[model samples]
Target: MTTFRKIAALAVAAVMTISMGACGNTGSSAADTQDLVVARSLETTDMLPQTGFSNGDIWAIQQVYQTLTRNKTDGSGVEPGLATSWKQSKDGLSWTFNLRRGVKFHNGRTMTAKDVKFSLDFARTARDDKPWQFLFTAIRNVEIVDDYTVRLDLNEPWAPLPSDLSMSASSIMPADFGGKTETEFRNNPVGTGPYKLGEWKKGDYIKFVRNPDYWETGKPKLNSVTFKYVSDANTRSQMVQSGQAQIDEFPTAVSVSSLKKTRNVHVESFPSTSLIWVNLNNRRKPLNDVHVRRAMAYAIDKEAIVRAIYYGQAEKANSMLSKNLMGYSKDVKDLEYDMAKAKEELAKSSAPKHFSLTVQVQSGDPEKSMLAQILQESWKELGIDVQLQTLDSTTVYSNRTAGDFDVAMFEMTNDISDPDEWMQYMFSSSANVNSGYRNEKVDALIKRAAADSNQANRLKDYAEVQQIIADEAPEIPLVYKPGLFAVRDQVKDFTVTTLGEYKLADTTIARE
Candidate 1:
């Protein structure tokens, strides 16, 4: 940083420090309300859960809708939600779920087998903007066994189905949607969860009210839950400290320490299936060669970045799979940060030492920006000129999908709580073909693991696949960022799942 830029940053920090004292707190009027507010960096215009994987959308929809299966609040595993019990066939082609009786939607309609089949059918057939359709693509048919039972017939044996059903995409809704059209239903959606949609101010905030006729007995402790949208991570942490929001969703990893030091604020972190990485386009020059990719990986320091950028909130990752993930292996050996190793690998590459390359990052991601700067300085030792280009999410994703850059920054999060749903995008030859990465061995292992019904065999396949991916080095892993949050001191019993789910059913606010 230049002297002038350093001075400007110090000035801004000074102003923020002074303002923190003047901000509100848990004792302030904002915290005195009966409702609990969660501050997030994004907003969801799409209220439907099956459409896209938005963190804010999942947090909101989970409060209003219940899926056939649900993640245990204590992070144990999948458990009964609307479905009282479920079992798969010995041949692994069919999955049968028994629904809970006397369950009611927000509109006072009782749930039945028809609702279960209808909801699954709605998710299976994608109409528009349904990125999670891949989760249900295996299902060829949905059959209503009885008024209280439903069965799903799959074209292939998809081992991820059971865990995938725990995602927000598999949420059960009223069969007729409470007599509302698509637009009308979106505006006033009804569900069988503990909360009801109250008001949604686009790009601003979404509010949910406690359901009076909820199936869960004596739950949803808060009178209302409001999700306030603030696009900056630093600002979200500040909001929690100021009591503007009782819970701050995924506060900046670098800012976790300072927020925890505050008297009225508490910082919480949990193991998560989130991996931040840089995909090296295997088809692009200077990055296409395995030696070049290996050299780049060795040259980049993940430990320094994770410590300085993520503070202590995350850990340096050796591979694409997070340690918290089910199929993660401790034996996969990837290139660690070593200047000597980098020089050794580069000597065998086409670029060898001197080459100017560009990496694309999404604008407004503070971590990515810091990471780019770190890369610019570190790779200079290897005679590499690193060029950074910041663009909007739409442009960044489009470029990534088109394989238009030498290197690109992105994060992979598991919404389904299963490794197959997230790992395939990184290593599977047929999946994410734009990455220009392919290996028959890795592809076969991924296929075997994804189709096998036996957990031990699946784990063995994934373990081998992870090693192959690390050795190939198509993508470089940076950090395994956990599900992090900042909350006011008064908020208690908030559980953070491996999938980063906001399990609010068990949360409680201190009355005192």
Candidate 2:
């Protein structure tokens, strides 16, 4: 399917929440409410694909699914998950995975090649729109060689196929789980991950329990985990401090400051792969001009946003990729913040004066508000009036995909180990043309990186590609947002990964 159509479908899918059942500890009383509960500002919709895909949803599902390989929370590349061992063909068109035996799903089904085939095939053809679907589209098909062996056949030479499978979407599910409607599965679900879906009370909380027959033996450190969607950052922080929540994700810096004053909680940060930027709506007349786009970049100050909003948690971005990535280029620096330069570009342009644009951001995100305020003030200096609109995460993604907003701000991650996996989705004509961006040179470079397997060549090619995009100024780079997550002091053996995912298979929570 085309990227636009997929994004439209995803927008529609976001309207509904996944309904699941709640199961308490088998040995405890019904009134017991304590379970490694964590609070966050958003809730996930049920239409989420079975694949360990989607941006925000992966954080929750990371506890419920396992991939062929996993990242160690410290920003490392790919590591093992379900498949204990794997081998690739010399031609790089075929791959075989050797699954660890004695794995069982939450539904008591033995995990086998059939399940692997079912999970991968469903991800490739699932009806619901998922953000990471772009990662799996290269696969022609998957074949079950034996009870524990699976082989993947690709349409073309794709070296990153194994690393792509290491992502969330490649999580294996029971064969029977395939071909089911998203609505049906949302209400009732099963997986082979560490925890099983229990009760989901919409607008209240989602509860989970340890899976007795989980593929990984004798693990899942916590007895249970529950997630509550408390949209207010203050409320989420208070919950953690009051012992109502054991952990939380990205509490406001202000709230974190207060928590540090009294609570025994600990804060941890990992290198986030997300790159937040302004998607200049090129369909508009003035922004269509390269000078206007360049001017917009110069007017906004990234340093202020990092200091005032992020409190130095974020690193200013000059290129599409993060500094930690293999293909990142350090030659590009932050655009100079000069109102005089911005006015110069506006005067030079043949476009009319008094240009206006709208930026859509998430309502609850503090950084979004800070960015919006800064842009509004900075652009005003150049006789440009910009409107800032804040919406929920769901609304933001929906409008962005539909091209409803003129200029929008949001974040994107490098999902696979290779940059091609992400760059293709961003620059490919087939992907959602956020900002209505298109360039033949960018397209050619992305394809070249996809076909080339040599590490040195791929890096050079991708570096040139990033420089090309930076020069053209399609999307304005903002900052590499830090992955700030808080865990209770007692939650030992937990490692924060660069990809922002957790593998609970071997984790253990100790308490005296």
Predicted candidate 2 versus true structure: per-residue lDDT over 1-512, tens digit per residue = 13223333432322121101111222122114325667876665552445323455666666766778776555556777788888878987888889888888777777888888878887787344554666777788798899889889888777677678876677776786745565666566666778888888865677778887765557775667777877655556656655566667776544444455534567767677778888887767777788888878888777766666665767789887877665787886545667687778777776537877777878766556656767777777787887888777767766766678888787766655667666876666655347777888877777777767887887887888888777667788998976666666655566656665654555444441
The local distance difference test score of each candidate is 0.77, 0.68
Each model's TM-score? Answer: 0.87, 0.87
**Model 2 TM-score on a 0 to 1 scale:** 0.87
Candidate 1 least-lDDT 10 residues: 1-10
Candidate of highest lDDT? 1
Candidate 1: residue pairs that collide:
none
Best by TM-score: 1
How far residue 356's Cα lies from its native spot in candidate 2, in Å, is 1.9
Clashes of each: 0, 12
